[model samples]
Target: MIQPLSMRGRHAVVLLVEDNEDHVFLTRASFEEAKLQIDMRHVDDGAKCLAFLRKQPPYEDAPSPDLVLLDIHMPRMDGYEVLDAIVKDDALRHLPVIVLTTSAEALDIERMYGMRCSSYIAKPLDFESFTKAVAQLAGYWLNLVVVPHRDG
Candidate 1:
């Protein structure tokens, strides 16, 4: 079935790297009401995020994401490693990565910044607030920001 309008003009593809099912649900719900169209695709672990970015098997047809919503903790290849890989890759480095995690540890924030992630926001403890935050965060980056072209 065809989905209702979720975005207005240009299609914004987002790769959400989150292991938790609840978080993913909230994120998807928020995007459904966003002012612009967002093509949100999800991967449960950082490893799949890497594979998607690399266009590896089973993801060979995945389009390059306009933005990445990353969670720090996962089963394999945590967010830190994914951020590192993106920064190290010339073709993928231009895509923006936003760390959306629960931990407020200074070291994690500092480390992600050092690794050249685009932004970092701690996930709110409550679901309502978290959903709003996700929408605003995504809206800002996907709608307002004029990011560099991801196609290289």
Candidate 2:
């Protein structure tokens, strides 16, 4: 299992905002296979994601996530809008948001970077490659990088 950051004093928490069920399943399985000891939460759309982050109504008891994995395509609201909201919010701006999507368009990449997304990862076509990528990603964030401590 991955060690929790010393600053956080507990297991890492991650929020995954994805509408595709298949992607969600694969992501969850990948983390499990890697034995990452993280609290992963899921929300299907941008609106719900925002609500969860803001701790509104149904998500009033939601934990503040250390990182967010966002998908670009979704109904109602898109990843760009959600990122914008997060960057603009004073309380939420410190969170890291990584874009994990199928699109690898130059324009999309440039736009996400312009909006201050922490990282952008295009989903691999093959299942094995995707699994490997997810493992690498988890290792990088959980073990390699230093992230801010989020109080519950």
Candidate 3:
């Protein structure tokens, strides 16, 4: 008989694609302060994000992310390109991606939705608002939503 998996020890893997150091720190701190029980892996560029997801070369042991928090503007590939590639890849397309960026451009929002982003959220400038938003997002995605298991 197969042993049951322990939920306490199994934390969701989150891939954060962000280039700005300040933003990264803020995002990390916000998540931590929110008491989220998940493993967050940071990628400074879209290329590295893709590489990690694909488990290419040096990232051979990288875990497949349960969710991806993407920033629209980044060096190398950018969020749009990364999203497109993810959608195109049969093995990775099922992974949920949320666009968490400072961009309020209508075109960007429309295009991201068209490409099947789980959701698009504009980053709040104020620390309080930012923390609240991050906490809510974490609660909703991690608790409310029924994510597909890795084997599924």
Cα lDDT of candidate 3 equals 0.87
Q: Write the per-residue lDDT of candidate 2 for residues 1-152, one digit (tens) a residue.
A: 32445235577888999999999998988888877788899999999999999999799999999889999999999999999999999889988899999999999999999999999999997778888998888778877887765565
The 10 consecutive residues of candidate 3 with the worst lDDT sum are 1-10
Top model number, TM-score? 2
The regions of model 3 sitting more than 4 angstroms off are 1-9
Worst ten-residue run, lDDT, model 1?
1-10
RMSD of 2: 2.7
Is candidate 1 or 2 superior in lDDT? 2
Give RMSD (Å) of candidate 3 vs. truth: 3.2
Error of 3 at 68 (Å): 0.2
Clashes of each: 2, 0, 0
TM-score, cand. 3 vs. native: 0.92
How would you encode candidate 3's per-residue C-alpha lDDT over 69-146 as one tens digit per residue?
999999898999999999999888988899999998999999999999999999999887998999988888887776
Question: Roughly what TM-score does model 2 have, to 2 decimal places?
Answer: 0.93
